[model samples]
Target: PRVTAFSKQLEKFHVIIDSELAVKMLRDAPSPGKNWSAFLKVDCGNNRAGVWWKDEAGVDLAVLLQNSPNIDFAGVYVHCGNSYHTSSSEEVIQVLDDTIERLMTFVNHVRQRGVTCSTVGIGSTPTCRKPTDRMKSLTELHPGNYAFLDVQQWSLGSCTEEDIACCVATRVIGHYPRRNQMLIDCGFTGLTKQGYGEMASGYGVIRGHPNLKLCKMTQEIGFVESLEGKLDYSLFPVNSLLYILPWHSCATAAMHSVYYVVEGDTVVEEWRPTRGW
Candidate 1:
């Protein structure tokens, strides 16, 4: 239904297909005389969405798409999202190597069946950030998260803390000396509740203050306390700004419509990203 509704606009875009049903959908989509371009999404190891790379059905689907008159079989697309679960950079490379080998084998199988895949690609911020020589064999790489890296990417060794480009700025709203906790203006609604128990600093990392931890958050307020000693209210006065490095920048960025691009201490530009699908 989506393809039929956006047929005119989708002619300029390449869609992903993982099954014969999707191919049929595109073939019958209400766009006459339009040979829709599409990539066969192959599941190397992510197991999220895509036909398994080793499955014979995948090869058959590739051939079917290649032979179809109403569709243009562009290539194979793989999302190596498993790389994000690794403990270290070496493990990330291991997953990358395994995914590449499996994808290449699948591509070879399709080639043997007389289907020429021009663009064999794999993508994830972890693998793409640390490129290997084996990646040269592929034609394209799409690492969307690298643009605004988060604490998760840093944990995966994909980038350093300095490489993180975006953060949520909140202000100190209240102080509680008895409980050794302070409140911030941002909460799950503003910063999201994604990284609970993931980082040592709790929901998000408080920038430039290693001693501080964002222990909890409500709909519109965040509870912050010192990780070690007692909380010092003098250090964080009311109305003072506290920047938080989100564990997932994509989720945090979705909460706001306008992004204030800052250089040093100056607010240089404001970018209003396009919303909705």
Candidate 2:
């Protein structure tokens, strides 16, 4: 197996066991060495991937993983993804506290069973960004989207517009004064069609053009409408360039193969991405 092959070379790696079946699978899969360990994933209300903290079955699985001689039980890990849906700082804090408490309670349960949990990891971009005082018990914080904050981050109150480091440059392609609509060259291909729930208006926000809304889109064309006053055609003349803050940076970046790294007006470098999954 790939894991068995890699374990032979790597110094250490922690496997995530979220269920009883996963524990059995890992136990059945022979290990080449003792360099690998396991992290019992706890579903601290995230409802995604992980064992429910309150489930007796989950705790029993954790104890099973801990008792396994071949695989070391490193600790517990939880991804508080529900924090992303938080609309206010209060909600963010609540999700973070609740998730952390649930994880700790589960950890205490495992520790009482005599398992030495070395790593207590928890993370979610929104929760990490606004962790009021919940960082006391966590040993590791893994916030992936902190690198390139997006409009969704801003909408979730996790960050401000100034915190967003990436934006898609789009060119005005067509104008229809009769319908009070303007078309841009960038659509789902360039600026992904992902939207921030309730907070975002359409596809993305036109940077510095607050009134202009990217209401509709096709493969290569984006329809922009004036949210407030009438759209000033002269202001955004055809061929003019506009920058759009994508709702989700990950989705937008995935659509492109190469990233044009820019610093001010200069094209500093070309960053190429890895091909395929």
Candidate 3:
């Protein structure tokens, strides 16, 4: 309980500090050992959590902890979530390079002030997969999704499309003559229902469903329309199963209680991964 309830137990139940709330807790917290050892979070590039690197507040908070009696400033932490915005190899590389340079600069500056800043941590799946030498100064690497990478990881070149081992198989249910739509049995429930719809291949990009476009979806239906508007799909028989590539693979995985594993002409077994609280 000392470890799992908190995040930075990687250091053996280490009570790692995080957020402005954590920082405040440390300021008033009692010393447990030589010090209440903790890590400081700075918004190096990822704005999701931690103190802002540009806020002056983040740096100041770290400085404050170092001088506090109850807490031992173990080190600093950060993640470059903005790196996820990179749409290409070159852009991903540049974002990684620039992020490391900036974070390390903060660490170097902190040291010049006589504070014993140690752990200079940073992360982002893309940056880690394509590491840069600037990160040699870091104390720890915290990457969450390295275990089972997905489509987003594939698009960023973090992992290949083949490395993505998850998908959904939904069957065609009906063809609408009035709206020129093909209805699939999978809706938000079956296909892990999600999409940016506006994108060329939204509502889960179909692998070989080439001439097809998923226009919209309801709770138990997928509206598959033709992008060309003239191509004939009358050949696809009802009840034909369709394989789907999820928009947010991580989220889609959450909806399934069990996975039906299959091999050619054989039913392997049922595989179930754990889920939400």
Candidate 4:
């Protein structure tokens, strides 16, 4: 296990523990010369991961982590991913409030049992972007995708179109006047087909082209058509570049190995994202 092999190197890092089996794995792991610091991931509302907040087994796991000599129970961590399903900032705030309430209640229950949790946190770009007064009680807020917001975030009212910091720049490869469609170099592999029905503009929002819609995509080709009437080939000639604001920036970014940091028509730097889980 990486934790067992590189315990010293990861002494400062906190691992999230959700189930009793995971706790057992950490306890059974070869002694890393130091106790593993961990946070109990609680499922406040987002049912994706973590132990259910109201489940007694969740509390038992917390207690087990606290009592284990091989592990140190740091606190609680929650991801309010359900907030992303909402359509407005108000709905996001409601999810935020409910998550905080549930998290605090669980923390209180843990505290009643003499388990001291030093950290209480919740995260999700939508909930974090639309903060409520109740969020003040949390010790930490982790909004990971706020760095490169996308159309999904905009649809959830987490941010504005201008706040989307990244896009896929594709070139026109072919023009189909008869079918009223144009082919682009970037497809599902490049931009990802994430926002299917979520956006009116289709897969992604074509920057500066309100009338254009990305109707379909193959592995390496995207079909773009006009939303209004006829396809204008003269406006977008072959080999011309078009920037598309992806629906999910995280998925789109994973398709590329390197990112060019641009500044006012000039590429000032290059960033290579770390690969692997």
lDDT of 1: 0.90
Best model number under lDDT: 1
Candidate 1 lands at a TM-score of: 0.95
lDDT (Cα, tens digit) per residue for candidate 4, span 1-277: 7647766776465689898888998888788888888999999989989989998888888889999878889999999999878867888888999999999888988988889899999889988887778988899988889899998888777778999999889999999988999999998989888989977899999999999999999999999999999988999999999999998999999999999889878889999998768
Candidate 2: global Cα-lDDT? 0.85
- Indicate the residue-level lDDT of 37 in model 2: 84
Model 4 alpha-carbon drift over 4 Å, by segment: none
lDDT of each: 0.90, 0.85, 0.71, 0.90
**Candidate 3 residue-wise lDDT, 1-277, digit = tens:** 2423342434443455556677677666543334567787767676676765666666676777788775778888778888788888778778778877777777776776778987777777777788767667777887655655666777778888666666788888887767777888777876655556534766767767666777777888888887766536566678888777776666777778887766753669997987545
Each prediction's RMSD to truth: 1.6, 2.5, 4.4, 1.5
Candidate 4's displacement at residue 115, Å, is 1.4
**TM-score on alpha carbons, each prediction:** 0.95, 0.88, 0.73, 0.95
Full candidate order by lDDT, most accurate first: 1, 4, 2, 3
Tens digit per residue, CA lDDT, model 1, 18-91: 98998988777776447778899999999999999999999999999998777889999999999988899999
Please list the residue runs of candidate 2 whose C-alpha ends up more than 4 Å from where it truly belongs after superposition.
3-9, 30-34, 196-201, 273-277
Model 3 backbone overlap count: 0
Off by over 4 Å in 3: 1-21, 26-37, 54-56, 66-74, 112-118, 143-153, 157-159, 189-198, 229-236, 257-277
The sequence of per-residue lDDT tens digits that candidate 2 reaches over residues 1-277 is: 8878878887886688787777777777876676358898889998899988988777788788877767778888999999987779889989999998899889888888777888999978998988767688989988878888898889888889998988889899999989999999997888866883433457888889888888988899999999888999999989999999888888888888888888888899998888655
Overall local distance difference test of candidate 4: 0.90
Q: C-alpha displacement of 249 in model 3, angstroms?
A: 1.9
Off by over 4 Å in 1: none
